[model samples]
Target: MNKPMFGIDFGTTNTRIAFYDGETVELVKIRNPDSGVDVANIPTQAGFDEKNGNWHFGFDAEGFKQPKDSMKWMLLRDYPVEEISGTESKELVTLFFHHLKAVVAEARADEYEGQELSHAVLSIPVTFSLEERRALCESVEAAGIVVEQIYYEPVSALYAALRENFRQMPIDENLSGRIAVFDWGGGTLDIAIATIRNGFLYILKRDTLLRGGKDFDQIIVEKAMQDLKSKYNRHLDSYIETAYHQKAADLKKTAERIKISLQNRDNFALNYPRFIPKGAVNPPVEEDINLNFPVLKENLRNWIGKDIEQGIELLKECICQTGIPLDDIGLATRCIILAGGTSNLSLIEERLLEEFGTLKFGPLEKIERVPPIETYSSEPRRFFSSDKFGREDDASVATAVGNALLAADGGIPTFTCDIGLIVLSPTGQPYPKRIFQEGSPLPIDKPIIRQLPIINRGQEVISIQIYFQSIGYIKGEFEIHVDVKEHTVEISFHVDRYRILRVSGTGKNYPKRTQQSQDAIMDFPIAFRLPEKLKT
Candidate 1:
């Protein structure tokens, strides 16, 4: 058999993996040893045990009896060690990946007993910075896995949705048109607008909203705590910020469960015994507190309504950024595909239907012959599908499944963030001067050349600082040992398919002393991330 290649969707709240061959894709299911039931994904969480000095992950971490070490979204930050103690965030992230690998190995021992699960295609958010991307690669490598490629989250989902829903139609036949992907996951809502032609997916615009299903869960948790205090006249705040104890862990778990149940039901009763043990809070509690919080779907909608509205606004902004006229877009759009777990919400689906027209699922419904479009037709029609993939919770696995197909056929990934250099203004303030814009295909063909005036002719060293979106900057210096007669240095920047930047510099004109051009090349492995404040 060919060497097994896995596709990993390393999400903020949950992680999933899949194996794909040239013809088919198989999601690698994890059989819980404790429950003896199979699950499609694991939570992106970790815990450090102080007593045994051992680390636990996923379900194990959630069930750890000791005080819970909250290490959920630390991987998203450049310097993630601020709140964490006992070990650095990188170590914990690596350990989580290691545990993930071990679990997969144990679950699939029958098929992949001797084969090494070394290679993988990983998916990441567009907001990841250069440092964050490097850290992720290092952690994955430390966990004994090599990253074959990194794909943007929304793009992978779009690709998967397109292929899965439109499998019968040839690309050139009826698949070419404008497409939008609304990927609402646990931690982020990613929207992408692209045009497909001749089987190639070209991303025209993309945006991210820094809120998602997790935020809804948090809102419910806070409300539940407030209700507990109101009815019992006792504070149930578990002091999660300073002391992440078992009570806080259990409370969060209960809140998450409540959120899931309320998705399909009209209401849910959150009952937990001993929610807060005696003396767990300040102004010492006299006795244990039990929570019996009654929640309604209307209450949930009211709580998260503004957040959901903001998400719709973001989608509008993404469509506008595509530079396509609304009328033309409505005419040309093939489908507005939905991916990620949050897309399963009825509220979101209803909002999409109200915003657009009625949506129709092409794969499920029989395709009938229709009249060809007239170029000047002005009638508004539905562009997005009402539902996707005809499965209960398929949105959760769309990205991983798409990534698995990409690993098999080798999908082309676009550069998701801006890459630029830090230039000084007349006031001596530094700012980014972008050379490579986002939404372009990877491995830029042409090099960007710039000429800089030599500040100090006496020093033969030239220093340059490159900025990656809003993340931070990295500095590189090139020394050209030549005559100082030439007052300017020429620098060229080229990015390869691996996202490695090759920067070369040389004296513009040869000095009469040597009459030779000296060149210095510096290779920097670079990746990009986006800013939290969406650009207007």
Candidate 2:
């Protein structure tokens, strides 16, 4: 039997997996081993148990009393060691994949029928650097799963939306029109502007912010702390300091619950016992907190309103960067599609509708004062009824769904390099060379070759420095020694599907003296950077 392919969306807060089984794409439900209770998604948490020198992941790590760290967004960036819960980032990521693989095996035991998990398409953030992408691939590979392709989360979400809404709209018009995907998930907010042409998704511009639902939860926590101080005239920071883990965890959970509840109802009153340090207060304090709807809305707006405006501005900037007229953007854009968990927030929808004019809420009819798509084509009406993925008010899994769809579609995942490559002279000064121009499609099958002629005799070493125009730094340097018989050195550069650059070459020798043979290879994993024109 052929191995089943899977799509894994590794998210900051939750991870979702999906697979296509010839008929339809279905999400895998991971059941807790002990409880046998199926969970919609697995929490992205892991811990290193020092006592056993073992690693725990997901729900297993939750049982550990020791400090557990979430290395979702932190793993993608250069984070300080002290901030990472005293565990190595790479180890935590590997542990996460190890547990994830076990869950997938159990969830799809019947479908796999004793076959090992072979192929998978992984979804990553648009802003992921090349190093981060390579790290993710290595971690997955270490867990015994083969990563077939790496896809952008927003692009995957767009694919899912296209599948859900394609038949209802005019194919030609929708394909030609601009589509903006606003993905506001747990850890980050990403906005991508693109158009579909000839059945291919063409991304024109994309922007990402390190802000999302978690930020809103933090805002609520801060407000709750302020409220407690105002009501009882006692700061809870001291109490939190006494039991940092438990108290902070309780506060964050309470805040998140209240925030989600506020979506359906106007207000919610949360009554819970306040944490009091022993001997700090004579009497125990019980807190009664009444969270008002208007206050929550106002606070949310205050916290993220500028972020929404920035997203809109980024969309405009992208259009400009693509050389499209401002007036034409409105006519070309079909609708602003919102995805991810944070997209459910009413405040986000209101802000997006105000800025973008036409917003697609995806079955969120309870959004007060917002208009829905009134008219529909004579296609299958059931498909347009709700969030077509069978999930209610949850667009968080859209990336996983779309990734599965794309994996089934069977195409090579492609990306464009934003920076142009240049080589430097022996004087240490950089000289521009368009080895690969900016906005060039990657996984270039053809290798770019450059030959350097030996200028001086007795030159022991020849140094060549490479620089990326967009990043404004030396990518790396290659050193070649000059033999008395060598005349010219040829360097060849090739980029693979994973954005890993390979450099190899041979040296040409002068006639008369026995030709000095040279064979060397250098590998560089290129990082992603914003386009030079787009950088501010």
* Candidate 2 segments exceeding 4 Å error: 1-3, 31-39, 47-55, 63-69, 76-86, 109-116, 167-174, 235-237, 240-245, 269-274, 277-299, 358-388, 414-485, 504-536
Separate clash counts for every candidate: 1, 0
The CA root-mean-square deviation of candidate 1, after full C-alpha superposition on the true structure, stands at 8.6
After best superposition, candidate 2 residue 13: deviation in angstroms?
0.8
Lowest lDDT block of 10, candidate 2: 527-536
> For candidate 2, what is the lDDT?
0.60
- The digit string of per-residue lDDT tens for model 2 on 37-61 reads 6755776766446577666767666
Pairs in steric clash, model 1:
128-529
In model 1, the runs with Cα more than 4 Å from the true position are: 1-4, 32-35, 65-72, 76-84, 109-114, 173-176, 233-246, 278-287, 326-329, 359-393, 413-482, 485-502, 508-536
Residues 365-412, candidate 1: write the lDDT tens digits: 222322222221111111112242223336777788766666566554
Report the error of model 2 at residue 35, Å.
12
